[model samples]
Target: MAARVPGPRPDEERSPLAVVLDVLGADEQRRTRIAWLYYVEGLTQAEIAELLGISRVKVVRDLQICRQTGLVQIQINGRLAPCVALERVLVQRYGLTQAVVVPSPHDPAHLPATLGVAVGAWLSEKIGPGQTLGIGWGRTLHWSVRALRRREIPDLTVVSLLGGIGRGSEINMYETASRVAETLGAQCYYLAAPAYASSASLRDMLLEQAGLREVLERARRADIAVVSVGSLGPESTNRRIGLLDEEELPGLEAAGAVGDLLCTFLDAAGHPVDHPLNRRAVGLPVEDLRRVPTSVLASGGPEKVPIVKAALIGGYVNTLITDERTAEALAAG
Candidate 1:
């Protein structure tokens, strides 16, 4: 018999970390640019080659040289501000890896758009060339995609974490991913199925589809994941898109559902509440998502506090993006 496999581990993370550290220590300008172009500017080797008037093979060599030397450094904005202070507290309180707190708007209606700007900019800086990103769809995520600046990130891939909503819903999973991909001139992988299946068997069949399977696997392998929470309100995509039958809403709430992520309902404690819909949902499971290297939970609004707090507490996300009011509210709780 072959060797037995043990439990899951992050042993694979060490190689990339060591390579990046070595790349950042080198003083060579071209090697530095190769790393910067790929990791910081999100350009692929081919694109960098074209821009620098070099061969694609040479571009690959230069990038490897970057890894051999020391070169890449990413700095988040650390200006001392009220929001920054709140971000610090949130990280400390929740054991978060990072937080991006925006100023609260007086008119709470503008909260999503305002926070969207912050998150969009943060994403552009965080994603590297030849990287993968998993994005969940919702109103806030839609706004964030719209706010993102158009730029090239060569070989970048954006994946839809959930399946589609209604046929024409503006914030469907595919729409969010395609919009971002268009902005970055990148690639995309979309699950070509509805958010939920007619039955658990049907959901299983859909997931086994060749194309969708590839997308789901890629989503699980993503280095960065950005997702949003959906409150259990009438305004939610589930209700608005008519995915949830009128009678089902009451049962979900009675089952202690506070909100949802990737169309899978979650309780106030961030555990998936027992519901029939979960078995039929065609989205990435929360457990699989938690294994992603960097998870960014971008959401705001008073209604989302419970779910957001739950997500953070459950270790679903390492980073958070929200407004000051929501931050303070989270702190108070």
Candidate 2:
């Protein structure tokens, strides 16, 4: 099937450069190849038109778009072809609106930091005024907060999607929301309750609280949600922050749980698994996330590749930012 493209309409307001570049920078492989061919391979529009079996007019338009959008830029080392190619593959494969893949470091331990900085840069480009951003917590997200460039957004609100993870680490739910809110010079709504209540009944009672209820409501209604996926390995943030017993891992694994988002466990297929802990969990449901306008998931590391793929298939994330290593792994699978 032919791929969709991203750009503004002819009548819409855009700089001449942006319009030209949009043509050249379109996600469709043919258009990209056309830009590459015309600029890099030194092919004329007519030659390219004959080569791709497309109309000469299309080649002209594509070239014009490339120029308008600044797709043609002089660089010291040239473009990062691998990351760009992988991003295109991911967008096509997962039906993502956008994909940002950063250079992967040799060590797996640093993937989150690398992915976080890239995600931060990507977010700065997409974020606008008056956006209510619902945020999830994890190591990668923590670094994202650090890397994010502070900006003022009028009436912007940042809501914590999960309940508090007090004093655990910099990546705690409280820390993530507060940091983003502070950076954006926006208001914040925190889920004051703990990540897991003492019991299902207690969870229900906590949910009934006016403060917690209000925040969760805002979270569900958020314009965008930024979250991370968690695998059920020894390095699992859910397992560590939940203070779960080692024995419980087997039960969750037995239940076919591969990973979790907002403390909602999921099977390999990304369906919410019927685990007993789910009843006591506090946060926005995955179904609720689907309702949000955009769900941005930033995660990487070899351990998370499978869960990330599951998240993609489950329709949990419309946009993804991760490291090239994980991106390549996802593409291969």
Candidate 3:
């Protein structure tokens, strides 16, 4: 009579796979047991063979079979696992519908591309036939075009939430909207004016124009809105693009402004600052952004943490896509 091999000790830690293996067929159980002992338990192949009452050659062949038949799988526990955990915490903490936390790139310069691909993949999944997407423009959004999958969705429309810049660049609002629409093979709508009007009266005039009003209305009614926050620091895109004047920075800061969403400055507590630029900017109101069914905020980096938090606090973003480091900072705050 053969000696019965002992099963796992009662005090031993069992992986989920170990628990499920009890119900497998005898032959399958043997194969998986050998695999478990060799791979998970860190037993030498000779020890596994000896413990399972199998020859060393049989142990090797069974381990091979486990791999071939999908019984053995390997997953590295790394940054991705922490990222998933962060995603869960962010959703619960911020009352968000969803949160996507990506692993930070090794090179800080690659951050935009990292975030861009994530947003691109998310948009590909969310946007569909007959859907209207409203979008804000920035460097990160410009990079998103590189990863966006081109697909023709019938009746799909893309509305630029902000007006264009006089100085043309790839990251310009006009170019961003046109690129996104072209990539998705969707109809495109532009605001048909500069991002900021020359004067408050001119802004009002542009808002009342038949064509511009039509686009703004389309933006207000969009099924989804994707936007990014801008810091009030010296490196702010708004300043570089001439949307804001250097002399106005001190006044905005004195008014408690920390960042801007769609060119509307917001304070630490997420209220709009009492600044002339907010009134003069040509775009969808931050309040209107909240009304969109799905408003996605995509931005990252240490510099963006404050603004991102303000946006989250203001209820401007229901969905967030950001890097692991930024997610950690937000969670810590």
Best by lDDT: 3
Task: Name every residue pair that clashes in candidate 2.
Answer: 17-68, 17-69, 20-65, 20-66, 20-68, 20-69, 21-65, 21-68, 21-69, 24-66
Q: Against the hidden reference, what TM-scores do the models get?
A: 0.75, 0.75, 0.76
Candidate 2's residue-wise lDDT over 1-333, tens digit each? 999997878888878987777775545556678989988899998999999888999998877665434444322334489999999999999899888887888877777777777767677777788889999988888877756667788898999999875556767889889988998899999899888887999999999999988998999899989999889888887667664557778888898988887788888788988877788889998889988888999999888987899888888889999888889998997
Clashes of 1: 15
lDDT tens digits, residue span 1-333, model 3: 999999979898988876776667678988978988888889998998888788999999998787544466443345578999999999988999999998899998888878887888789879999999999999889877766767788999999999888886768998999989998899999998988888889999999999999999999999999999899777777878776788989999999988899988999899999988888899999999999999999999988899999999999989999999999999997
Report the Cα lDDT for candidate 3.
0.89
Q: What count of clashes does model 3 give?
A: 0
lDDT of 2 at 16: 92
Q: Among all windows of ten consecutive residues in candidate 3, which has the lowest summed lDDT?
A: 68-77
Q: lDDT, candidate 1, residue 114? A: 74
Tell me the whole-model lDDT of each prediction, alpha carbons only. Answer: 0.83, 0.83, 0.89
Best by TM-score: 3
For model 2, the superposed segments whose C-alpha errors exceed 4 Å read 1-79, 166-168
Question: Pairing residues by index, what is the TM-score of model 3?
Answer: 0.76
